[model samples]
Target: MEQNLSLEQIQNFKGKYPRQLWYLFFSEMWERFCFYGMRGMLVVFMVGQLGMNDRIANLQYGATQAWVYAFTFIGGLFADKILGLRKSLFWGGILMIIGSVILSIDPKNFFFIGIGFTIVGTGFFKPNISSMVGQLYQDGDPRRDAGFSFFYMGVNLGALIGGYICIAVAEGSMWQSLVPEHLRWNVGFGFAAIVMIISLLTFTQTQKKLGTIGISPLLEIESSKRKRMETLTYVGSLLIIPVIIVMVANTVYTDYFMMFIGPASILYLLYEMKNFSAAENKKLFAALIFIIFSIFFWAFFEQSGGSLSLFAVNNLNNTILGVKLSPNGVNNSANSFFVIGFAALVGLVWLWMAKRKIEPNTVIKFGLAFLFLAAGFWIFYYTKFFAGADGRTSLGLFTFGWFIITFGELCLSPIGMSAMTKLSPLKTQAVIMGMWFLASAYGQYFAGLLGANIAEASEHATNLEKLNVYADGYKQLGIYALIAGVILILISPLVKKLMQEVK
Candidate 1:
């Protein structure tokens, strides 16, 4: 007689998590440390050190972020089908190390060179690590969402350290007597490189514990057909480089990325739709809707790195505990701090509500995210009327605004990952996860466009004047967010029905 699985066994089942996940987690953590640490400094460095205008710095930052998120989808695809997660991850670490070293060189044109390598490295690293987390669990595993939560915590942990700790070290004065000015920033990059090396070493040492996970793809497929297909795809993709270059160059005239990703995403969805049952179809629809709305939320929220960063610099006083702070880095830290502190709270609330059978569904969480986001920006706008002669606003106001935005991110970001893992059927799990990430990529792109818009009018404006312009833009975004939030709240009940109690 065949054995049937019982509820107790299913609920209590422990997936084998060896040392590998920890290694990957730490590796990812350090990589983020490098990425966010650099990011925190980039705006300040560009404007302060390089004498670049606010508009240029904002544009550059947005473009870099857009490429980073966009490549997550590419990384996911290659890992799932070609290089396998392990090799891709290892190579990614190597590339990032190279990038960091190049950045440390601090050449006149080091920005472009370092960013180029970082983008390439991120393309190999980002998606594969997330996929490996899923690989740790089995099909129909309820724990999958929880596992991703654990993984995302690792991401936030790195961000927390990078945003505050690393930045503090690089820019801090406690060690200033011991370190020279020219070498200070270089020390930061060096530290990042060392961390990458440590992560790479850690992963290699823990390989045996990982079991057969993240192995190379060559082991699975036959040599002949797979080789031909890989070569063809690579060549075809390369051949389209000129076309992509032209599109990127014309980003102003056309929403080239959306024109491509939107139709492509729709086609892919339709193809996948046929394979799903009615219940699964409903879940997919719900996810799709959430993804669209989430993009709008992110476009506004992501200003933290662009307009908000600038605001913290030009418009807000940065003195804290008698130590002068970098405006850009200090405000960015708020989001990460909230993620670390509130992730557990959010998780607990979900569990507590689930037990009472009164948990607001995923859609509700997203709607609330929009409300918080809009409220934060509106609060930011309120501070503008009190601007000082130097155009500096109260630091307390910026802090309070960041606190509100943190709650918004906590609701939307972690929950989106949870919903994606839960609602996706087993066979298409990785693809769906990739698509989830793809939406984020689109959001990052839109964020760039938005930042570019605010900065454009202020091209010749002083930093303070440009900040006022950005604040006005924030007020408008606040209105847009409010409208979007209400719409989501109205349809949330219907979306909740489609969820089928996956939570």
Candidate 2:
């Protein structure tokens, strides 16, 4: 496959995809195992183990997620010009392993340190690996979207496994014989670190399957120049560690940092826009529009880890068929389980639609995503009416809500990844991918802010009061999302024009 077949021959490849897809698939699976494992437990650990209030925990979690994504810009810059994707991924995986290990120690001061390292590590790893996936196919490859969906399935597969294992272990629902209850969170973190080591090993052993793809910097540089760039990256990374630690510890700093960085990043992207041709510029403008819309989508969608998790704990009856389950565990694993079960079907549907040239364009797909998101939230919001005397909704409702959200994710997330590669100039692929995730950074920060508000509003309130607060919030968000989806649909024709038929 690496021999660069013509489009016809490439389209005729086995399994309708390249062999390297599996290597990347498994590598990303394990990496996500490490990432989601820790993430599933973070807010819960803060609330339970560290005795933090929900407001504080939500803010910190938001800051951590925001910074983790924000650093992708720096990592993408390094990979595009200096380290290349392979080296960036390797170093990123190493740092993540280290961070997970630090979290396993469960020391107080080291909490932020661990989060800091993991954030920077993820910044380096996540965007580069995804960019590598895009590198596998030529421009206009018909198989690109399906391949990404299959790859996305791998991501959810890992998330499913990691979410269940990490949450079960943290809750002492599993491994009680070997892991003490008080130390279970540490064990969960350690398990994540072990999986990261496996991810690094898998990628290292199988990267040869990728041939020359992601093997070198996009632009050639002298050895001395490369060395200096690497040195600067190292120094800058080290310098930022303490700053991230400080920012995470202080909400004021975190807010100010995001406010400044958000505009600054957009300005830089605009400056880079001058380098593209007119057609490329139009596509980028469209990309930016989609990016902005995605921020809103993710802000609500990401509640799975924050408000939704809390809702499960506080207001959901977590019994399924008379068996008890961990609320957060179920919540964390729900969307992933649905994605794992349905992503192939979704992919096949896309392929079938594409055969007739009827597949939705990127913008329309994004609009569908918002519509689904609104529907999912509305599903949950209306459950307030079904609350029993105990003020608990059925576990089935939460599960169904996530199932719907998974459909929305299917429409937006992977398509957004593919779109970044297709829409941006080749020179700025990684940077634009980073910007795509930067939208996620903003979404995470907004989610944190929203979660904090909900926490504060519900403080010392009854279960009914909490339900009412959440219901009101979800209703407003749902209406907003529905309106956004409508707007996007109306504007999609124009956006497609700007895209210059890249799809």
Best by TM-score: 2
What is the C-alpha lDDT profile of model 1 across 343-396, one tens digit per residue? 666666766676687877777788898899999988888877767777787676
Q: Model 1 — which ten-residue stretch has the worst lDDT?
A: 1-10
| 488 Cα displacement, candidate 2 (Å) | 0.8
Look at candidate 2 and tell me the lDDT of residue 189: 86
TM-score of 1: 0.85
Q: Residue 484 in candidate 2 has what lDDT?
A: 89
Estimate every model's Cα lDDT from 0 to 1.
Answer: 0.70, 0.85
C-alpha TM-scores of all predictions: 0.85, 0.95
lDDT for predicted candidate 1 compared with the true structure: 0.70
> Which residue pairs does candidate 2 place in steric collision?
none
